[model samples]
Target: MADYSQSPLELLLANQQKGYVGIHVEQGVPVLDRDLNLLQDLISATVRAVISRYVGNGAAAGANGFAVQALPTGQNGQDFLIAAGDAGGPGSALVGGVEVVIPAAVTYRSQPGLPALTAPTAAQPDPRTDTVYLDVSLAEVDGTVDAELNNSRDVGVQTSVRLKPVWVVRVSEGDAVPAPPSGHSFYPLASLLRPRGVATLEAAMIGDLRQRRLTVSDMERRMSLMERTLLLPAFTAPAPGQPQFVPKSGVIGQPITLNGSNFAVAPVTVRFGDLPAKIVGGASSTQVVARVPGGLTPGGVSAAVRITVSNLGGAVISDDTFTADPAPAFAEPTTQFSPGNGTPGTQVTLNGFNFNAAGTQVRFAAVAATVVGVPTATRMVVQVPAGLVPAGSTNADVKITVTNPAGSIVSDDPFRAELNIPAPTFATTPPQFFPKSGVAGQQPIILNGNNFNFAPVTVKFETFTAVIIGTPSATQISVRVPAGMTPPGTTKDLKLSVTTAGGTATSTDIFTING
Candidate 1:
């Protein structure tokens, strides 16, 4: 009764033309093979063949999950349908753009609010995880309808096999510990040290003996000196055979220079590695020139000098690498220092080689700092600022940026800091102060307030007639009456006031003070 006159493909296409994605392959007939093995094989083979033919690849080698599956029917017979997939045809040779969707309600384990992935605590599983099932179907062509669907199948008509990753697990008793193999002993330290007469207490005794080999006072002094002798950044020595080399024959026995500012100068020794280079005297932060030892090899070299200052600790700073040219020139600039980096004061130094030239002056922004020595092309020393540049990023441009420039002319990224540079507000509680009755320049006269902003602010004390001296900072002020102030009786009334950049604050009170 069904149209047996057409081929199966024609019938399938005819049904597809009617907009039917799936048609009854077997209608009203009970499938005795409930094992589903034969049905699965048939579906798989059909899908694989169709996909392969359309893809022009001779087989569905690259296709993944290319298959069709049977669905359960309401009647005694079974029903089946294809899922979402691309039908490869002449125009579209690739069976691509296939997707299947199924939704289910299930529970899943999730992770949340973990500090780190390495150590994660288990969270409660949510039962509302979405479960979507996807199945693939093969695609074919219908004459004018554009596309047709078919159940995919394998060539051999075999059920498709699935591969799952498996994890191998090992189980053991909770307290079971694995034994160390071969030469490794259960107690490694005891086995190694005991035979050498170094058991715990014995080892402590050996340590004590080794320690006692040196006199405590000598060790302590040496260590104390060594500890105090840390190298500051400004010290760098000169190399041989470089510029500023003096003729050794004339002053060959003369000292090589140690050029730097803010250096610790004392008795010094110049050396290469552990080997002493030479010994010559007269050391200062500006110059530590020692004669280069004769009979030195000609090659790259690293040398250092250790200086022990009087009362202060010894300082050891290193020299840069240089070639040893038999000929040497010596030039050193004077150490000039003023103040900078909020350092209260600044100092500069010139040491080692090429001592003289011309055209030098030290400039710092709108401020002028004094030069220490005669300005020379090789050596120019200048001072820095005493007051700090305003807080925030500040640019410090040096005057005489050229002559023997240790740093760049346009100094970039010079300084940055956070400063609470207040607009200078004056504050005080009980803003008036006076000494006890009859007390002159007496005790316990103080003004207290806040917002000092860590700056040294001068407080000008004044009465309408003459100016007075208040304390010199933002937070608090205390002043002693000048030695000459005639008091009325033992106590006298005086006016008190405070002034700042922001404005002046006055307490209109006559205070009684001990004269």
Candidate 2:
């Protein structure tokens, strides 16, 4: 037998044939013939067979032997003989060859004191093999288990069977291994072995062979049980007085830390209610820093939202709900009101984002405006409420504020509020109409007043209309009385009035018209 413990180069040199191209062995009878050509062919065939077994069977064959038949000689009975001086030298001599002999078949047997039906418990490192082995039993095979069998005569043909043991290893839950299916605890060692079919023996085996098979099965079952009992990872909520989230309450987009145990050292997802929050930095087994998700309502004012963390193991929800405070933001209003000023009763339109439809209010300086109707989140219509500014003030510059339960935001610029003009009034000493008693169209009347510079002014005399003769001044206007005022010589009393953008003003004193 070759000493496999030696290095490949050393082993090859130790088995090298002398003056031949193959390995040679010395025994009672030679294990390899000395014929150079035959020896070379035998070595080549053996190597090829071993390689084929490894490739075709997916593993190296254990406890197997190869047979090499001797080559037949030619008719001259000197076919393998070489003549002197044929090659190398003329002094070369023919070397006598030994006949090869096959060794007797042997059977493996379990030695006495071998471990019974129990998994090996002692682990020892074998540096020569670079592997860890379990020391359990000392088994001697080759039918030498009993002293009486050492000298026993050869009997029936020995049958051999290969033993392929499957190994199951347990690792910590933190190890990078695919999780087994639910309710199971073991995963196959994918790098070491694969499933294959087993062939049945054609002939019946003796009592010893049957007992050996049972023993192997018992050991395999016990090893499987040990693997199945491996500890599974566990998770528990933080103990009392431990912080769950640092500074628990905050506005949206604020970063907060979540502290817990048994968190997988992998990517974890955080959710605020049904919305996913942005994770800041990274997550570890005990701490994760995350940002508060937007769209969460303020606590007390609105229902609190549940916070959850999910990882490979499973998902865990915080017992206490996360309280998100309201954050309000405002944008510029849409349309520019004509004159950029208004008083009480003026309808104003506001456009912006993040406005609360139900509890939103618009304020001018410190005074609140009357919302026309239910406001939308992005738009609202409000009326400038009374007392927004002092009664006599011409205009007031004040900040426009939008308030909601979340918070309040003020416009970057101020809005101007102008005083409303009262109805037009006649001067204390009212202007008189010239030609108090004049026939219609026969004469034109001239009226004088104050505050009449506004365009589109009109003048009326009782029920009769008048036409302005020319452009009206701030204090005076000329008009021709309508011919229909009355009959040509009829007399009647008529009230004169003037109208402008401010409003209408009538003359308290009446004038008598002559027909």
**Which of the numbered candidates is closest to the native, going by highest TM-score?**
2
In model 2, the worst 10-residue window by lDDT is 201-210
Alpha-carbon deviation at 501 in model 2, angstroms: 4.2
- Model 1, 290-360: lDDT tens digits are 55543232221222323321214444444343233232222222222222232323554433222232233
Q: Give the per-residue lDDT of model 2 (tens digit) for 405-458.
A: 777777765678765655555556644667666667644677777766565688
lDDT scores in order: 0.33, 0.50
Give the Å error, residue 53, model 1: 99
Model 2 spans > 4 angstroms off: 1-419, 441-444, 454-456, 469-474
Clashing pairs in 2: 488-515, 489-515
